[model samples]
Target: MSQNLLIVGAGEFADIAYEYFTVDSPYTVVGFAVEKDYLTEDEKFGLPVVALEDSVTRFDPAKTEAHVAITSTQLNRVRERLIKKTQDCGYTLANFISPRAMVWRTAKLGVNVFIFENNVVQHGVQIGDGCVLWSGNHVGHQSVIGDYCFLSSHVVISGYCKIGARCFLGVNSTLADSVTIGADIFVGMAAVINKSFEDAGLILNGHPAEASRVSAYRYFKLKAPT
Candidate 1:
């Protein structure tokens, strides 16, 4: 495994990723990269901040792997797009599963996933690519979290639950067993989902969650689920 890592993004998430990867993982923080337009800072954490377009030329992708460390901007679309761009730059995407996390042996995670400490991933769980699970979440047995989803800290997704792609689960939210959420859904903070929702682009909130009048897509300024 490559020890050098090029983090894509110079913002807060990038800073957080840099710290976690440097102190907790085997990979060393080599540099930071962002789109040319957003390249304002000269460096981050004493490392060079290069333009993402010139990253491959500056940092050899063969020796330096990359991680797209953007938060759930644009309902995870921005992060997803950046991940693709990094892939186009010929850098192999790296996943960081914190050693403090209690991930069951039967749990499977896809590429570019960022899982923080104190997460309990039960058996038969399948987490998709580009997903971000913040600290202290509980992903129960046989649950499936889809691609590009963001699970905020302390979420409890019970067993057999299925969350669709690009969903943003707010902090302290709890999904009861067998709950199914559709793509582009936004589960609000501290909300509790007890049933199933198959409709995409819905805003689910409130205790014992209810769909909001505003569409998740509309609130996110997206015309539809991408």
Candidate 2:
């Protein structure tokens, strides 16, 4: 059963999401929806581009599904905001779990999730809404990834770990068992986390992954998540 789907952007990530939904999932991509300000083109990949606010009118929300096709810009706040926007606009959100990825039947995932190839989401994992698990990542058992988090390729999240909202785990980063990360934190590339970080907005980097002097919001030049 291929459901009609509307990807919520027309950028690079949107193109990737469209291809994945069209080829792998049971989704027939019907169109794209983005803000009018960023809607540069009238069409993308041969689909019509509608304003995000107007998507529900163009495509009946009950009949169509939407997935936010945004990346880790502004520490994933962009994706986070867009997900909320779509939900508020009365559209049913969609999830794209790759056929190639081995997602455990017991693992629970939220709406608009994009799980790429070669990822292992182990038993009892709870991945929140709008998260992106990029290719080749390993999520160990009972881990909790919060809403709008982005885990880059090959990152390793060990057993029983908890990650907070709008966080970005860089490529090849490693988290030890039972570790907890707070909201809006950025784990730099290849960093290793062995302990829990309770504080929010920290920029973590290095082998043992110490927090840098600069705040994550400041480093990203973002005011904060509104």
Candidate 3:
């Protein structure tokens, strides 16, 4: 019997995965699953919607594997939540590494990973499970990317860096060698991290504007006659 595949979340990413599954993959996509609150459509990508809570019954894991297609736009919270949910329901998360992706033989990859096209995972690097490495990114040698991390496109992670779990590295971001990014941190797009980021919060790119608050307000047309 052919392997059954169920994709969680029904959005743009799901659409991409569905296309890949239909054309490139050998497994059949049985349905889409989502949380009760976010389950909007009766069907997605032309496949029936199966609630994440009842997915195991609707799609048997023994015959089917599931994948979480939630975009990592907001870090790992969305993907992580669905991963735990599907796993707890006795379903295994499937990893989809596009055949077009260039991954070295020595590179280590964990389960449920989504690696898109034109991405390069160099030798000796370790990517943990539940991670989403978007298209066009370069992960350098010996880098340790923790579980549940999300890396957007065109990002460059230099050699030997440690990226913590649940971290969100935005598009075009670059992390220099040996830098340690703490868990739950949000690195904005185009940010260059030359040093370690130990704090876990929003770290926007570029330095703060030098102009004083009042001066900046007036310059931006925010100040009005009182």
Looking at model 2, the pairs that clash are: none
Model 1, residue 83: distance off in Å is 0.5
lDDT of 2 at 188: 85
| Tens digits of per-residue lDDT for model 1, 110-188 | 9899999999999999999999999999999999999999999999999999999989999899999999999888888
| Winner by lDDT | 1
Residue 49 accuracy (lDDT) in model 2: 96
User: Least lDDT summed over 10 consecutive residues: which range in candidate 2?
Assistant: 198-207
Provide the clashing-pair count of each candidate structure.
0, 0, 0
Checking candidate 3 for backbone clashes, the offending pairs are none
Residues 7-111 of candidate 2: C-alpha lDDT, one tens digit per residue? 998889999998999889889999999997887788887789998877778988889988999999988988988999999998888999999999999999999
* Model 3 per-residue lDDT tens digits across residues 127-163: 9989988899999999999988988889999999998
Show the colliding residue pairs in model 1. none
Q: Candidate 1 — what's its lDDT?
A: 0.91
Show model 2 residue runs off by greater than 4 Å: 201-204
Off by over 4 Å in 3: 207-226
Estimate every model's Cα lDDT from 0 to 1: 0.91, 0.90, 0.80
The 10-residue segment of model 1 with minimum total lDDT is 198-207
Cα error of candidate 1 at position 213, Å: 2.4
